[model samples]
Target: MNATNSQSPTIVLVHGALTDASVWHGVIRLTQAAGHHVVAPSLPLRGLASDAAYLESVPGPIVLVAHSYAGSVISHPATLDPKVKALVFIAAFQPDAGESSAELNERFPGSKLGPATTTVVPRPGGNDMYLKPEAFGEVYAGDVAPDVVSVMAAAQRPIDPAALGETLPARATWHDLPSWALVSTRDLSLPPQLLGFTARRAESHIVEVESSHAVPVSHPREVTEVVLEAVRCALS
Candidate 1:
């Protein structure tokens, strides 16, 4: 490969909370076939620092792509490398410096858009909650595949509610990297508008899909297109 093509950007898939990297299974093959390398890790579910550290172990100069709560996991500098060329968020939270996911839950009274699960757990490693599946499809990712959503609801690992309460000590590449975002119009959890707000911080190239929050599974073609674009950007 030529020198320019020699450094093709790799796509790092970061799945949201209560799920593992398997959540991205569908898109991986397509990405690799399209001529990009891909790496997605299972966040330790341990805590914020450990999870970020785990992700940092992946090869550098990555095009980090995150979905749902996984976006927060990628916000750390340890998980972030200098060669990381860009970021792509799929209905994911891309917070600016000194910002927390709490801002997403900073509800205006009567605002009906928040995680609807009755139980929220605080894992020792980070902030995440294992909400019920029915409650999940009803709230967080109603648009996801039924079977996968069922599995996610049933096997959801506990997340530390305190993960949100405590702040990380690093920067998200959104401030500097070339970024892109995929937003769903029918999302009930984070509301489409709220996603717009989170996306603004990214200064990203946005793709408004008419689907719901579980965008990767629901709209693989669209998600793949965005990933392709990010790879092209990074490799350029």
Candidate 2:
């Protein structure tokens, strides 16, 4: 039932802040049903360098896909693995060399992920940030079912505040890799305008979907289609 050939790239799905790899559940199911091998890894969300290094360790010949803050993770120079053929960003950040996710998230005016919407918990190394359960649906997944949003909010993973401020390395993988982006028109966590700007700045092929920042969850079919497109282009 595998649709991919031996030469086809593996799909590596990276999740972002406030959520874990489970965010890609539907996308993984769809992608796998299409016969492609897929891996959605839980990022440490400690900082950009460490997170990128962890992602770099995944076996490759990969079509790397990232969501929200994970855009910064996959774009790190450390992830410039030769086997990584393409990058797919889903309502994600695509920070430049000196840019940080925090900076980019502020570039446009629409993000509702500020202090009032989130809670800060002091951890051993740094502050951990979480979206308040009440704010999760409106800010991160407005299009998703209330019941599903409830579980997502309860199971959400907190990310180190430091990770949002860490800048990318001097070089970025998008600088050399072919990339595609899916911009969520209804995203409130990362402004849709910010997403479009970053996507164009990377010269990435773009697709627009109507969903929340949790596009992978609310619109998995669209996300999977974009990933499959990247795979097709990479194989071509």
> Per the 3 Å backbone cut-off, how many clashing residue pairs does candidate 1 have?
11
TM-score per candidate, chains pooled: 0.84, 0.98
Top-TM-score candidate index: 2
> Candidate 1, 155: how far from true, in Å?
2.8
Candidate 2 TM-score to native:
0.98
Across 49-98, the per-residue lDDT of candidate 2 in tens digits comes to 99998987788799999999999999998898889999999999999899
lDDT of 2 at 17: 97
C-alpha displacement of 136 in model 2, angstroms? 0.3
* After superposition, candidate 2 runs with Cα above 4 Å error: 1-4
- Span of 10 residues, lowest total lDDT, candidate 1: 105-114
lDDT of 1 at 130: 67
* Model 1 quality (TM-score): 0.84
Which residue pairs collide in model 2, if any? 3-35
Go through the candidates in order and give each one's C-alpha lDDT: 0.71, 0.93
Task: Name the regions of candidate 1 deviating beyond 4 angstroms.
Answer: 1-6, 107-116, 121-128, 168-171
